[model samples]
Target chain A: MNIERYDRQTILKEFGMEAQLKLQAAKVLVVGAGGLGVPVLTYLNAMGVGTLGIVDNDMVSLSNLHRQVLYSETDVNKSKVVTAAQKLKEQNSETDIISLETYLTPENALRIIADYDMVIDASDNFPTRYLVNDACVILNKPFVYGALHSFEGQVSVFNFEGGPTYRCLFPEMPKADEVPNCNENGVLGIVPGIIGNFQALEAVKMITGIGEVLNGKLLLFDGLFNSFQKIRFSLNPENSKIKALQDSYDFNCEVSVNSITSDDFLQLLAENEIQLIDVRTPKEFEKNSMSFAKNIPLSQLEERQDEIIFEVPVYLVCQSGVRSKKAVNKLKEARANAELINVDGGMNEILKHAIKY
Target chain B: MEILLFGIAKDIVGRSSFRFEEGDEVPKSVLELKQKLNNSFPDFGKLSSLAIAVNSEYAQDGKSLQRGDEIAVIPPVSGG
Candidate 1:
């Protein structure tokens, strides 16, 4: 296919022409083109990975240039996937880069992921992460998991060769507030570049079977400390129970349970009819938090087993409201008599006047 | 127990590692150790989703910790 182009890697004893041939036949779908996807696609193309699909709904901004090196000032405000595909095509004419200019929604995840041999999770948010995991789980495709925050990042391979999945390692999703996204918490430009390079390596390893892919092992990279920790994780059958793709990241709730608008949430807070529990961590709480809210981080919610007053409804909230919805589920399962509700949009809405249940 | 922290766990604990000497005031189990940390640093409570590692392997909440057990708090990260 492209043996001559990959001769440098093909010459290696471990990664000979056989591995190069496998890489040429491999079809990979990368779910984001922000920071991680950019380098991942670049390296994969350089390695001559045959079929590459890119999914992204975001447009490049001036802010994207620091880390997303593929885009330029002229490319600002243009579609990320489109720009990525064009750049990658120019960089490697042998690799076919297909650009899908849309967000990876649950409705479209399976169809897109099914068309690929494997998926690389380069998304920046939790919803897409969970969606991609479930889609790959259903499709029975191996996925390279990559996530980063500020100076730290994690790389792992899930569902490959019957190893553990992302849900196996992370049973619960952290509240959005607890997560230090690159946008708010701020990440060094090199953080994702390093992590993305690892992801590309993992994909190449998976495709060519050249090296030991990080299956069942979670690799954490702390850019600040320049340290890497590879932690092994056992398969958790209980956590791998994904029968279908979920509509929301709210723990597969079919209906929003006792969800209240921000107006009603504040009104209840003012009237003292409802108790507001910010499920975000105390560090997040200290950073411009709602004064009326109580600081009960989700991790310590188990200690609040006896503190629940069944009569007063407890409203749970986090950054984007995904974690609060999870808190609501946990409370509902543990305390049947307790009335637990979720405040939609979490602090994002609290910051903005408009809110939804 | 000198508990080590990684990723967002470090942000919550404020330090990379802290000692939790076994005693009446100290914790004997992983769950208890987490509760103690949560009390000291309320941010630890936010990481309800974190996994604990004793020595090198992952330990369950029910796993008991000895006096010299090396502990590390692991937090899930999402950025890229």
Candidate 2:
């Protein structure tokens, strides 16, 4: 490590030559290339964190340019990781940048994260977050979590040796609708910038072995009021109960949970009072069945709408409530008169509740 | 009774640590306490949809609160 390159940072009492060397030797994997990931990757690369892995499956959209400062107008429609990796490599050729142009599925999670010393959760979805946390816990690696919504941001370190885990803070995940993403609810541009900067600081701190890391505490920040607070939580023993989560099983489980419950909606079908529409794949319908439902999957719902009579309430059922709700919302939006009722518990929950039905 | 506070509620109350009566409930309904605290202190009125947890466990809507509970009035949680 050349002393001149980090002269400004080296002179600081806390971060000296040894800290720079630690940063140079550190290998970090950032899980997203949007919003928070941009600033985090930038600062980490600028500080010379030796090898950086950027993971993302999305392409830059016009809307992404607002907070994803890494991409330019010309880079729209380009793979996020590719563009991000290129830009970051240009910042400092000495810092090696590798891009994974795909989503972080559970199958590849451990493999991708195994090589990195520390991981950062900058992804935007619950499944990804849970997957990342579980993978981190299993790997026994410290993961710095950062998320921004509206004007608020949260930062925490999960599975840090004996520290509290994400499950300790939130034992069970909420319904997807309980929290909306930035694309749906919107967020301040600077919110991620601030949160991402904090993530970079935490990463640097973790690497250099300086400062009190956010081990067992969760830090929340409010941009509107400029306030900060730290809440402490203890590790939950039950987190270990989720011993192993395979890719297929987890994906199916998530989809099933999101699906409408059969018990709640099947009663209507058992009495022949309402019409049930199976908006799932033919294979899904073959595997599961409602008492009296038509096999018009969502792919064909639009063209085959005439096949089902409009005399009764059309109860929509899919693998999860997501597609069914979307179908109902779309039907309502199109001014369709058939009564639209979306079963809350999708097919998976429904079957669990009403196995005989 | 002394109950330590954290998150946005601490800032609203003006101090991170404070004392209050245990009240009637073992874990008092956060809504009722929020109203009383706002009426008495008047500043916490702006905090709404804030989650309440006692001793680090999320509290039920009408549960009674006890003394020494680590009361945290969390702003909308945005953690990943």
Q: What is the lDDT of candidate 1?
A: 0.81
lDDT of 1 at A210: 74
Query: What docking grade applies to model 1?
Result: medium
lDDT value, residue A24 of candidate 2: 95
Off by over 4 Å in 2: A246-357, B1-70, B73-80
Model 1 agreement with the true structure over A1-357: per-residue lDDT tens digits? 655777888788998888888988999999999999999998898888999999987777676799998999999767788888888988889887888988898888988898999999999887688888888888889999998877788899999988889888777766555666665467788888999999999998888877699998888777877887777778887656677887766443565677887777776666575567888777677764687778787778878756656677788888667667867877888887887888987875665543222
lDDT of each: 0.81, 0.73
Model 1 ranges with Cα > 4 A deviation: A250-357, B21-26
Report the poorest 10 consecutive residues by lDDT, candidate 1 chain A. A348-357
Relative to the unseen true structure, what is the C-alpha lDDT of residue A259 in candidate 1, on a scale of 0 to 100? 81
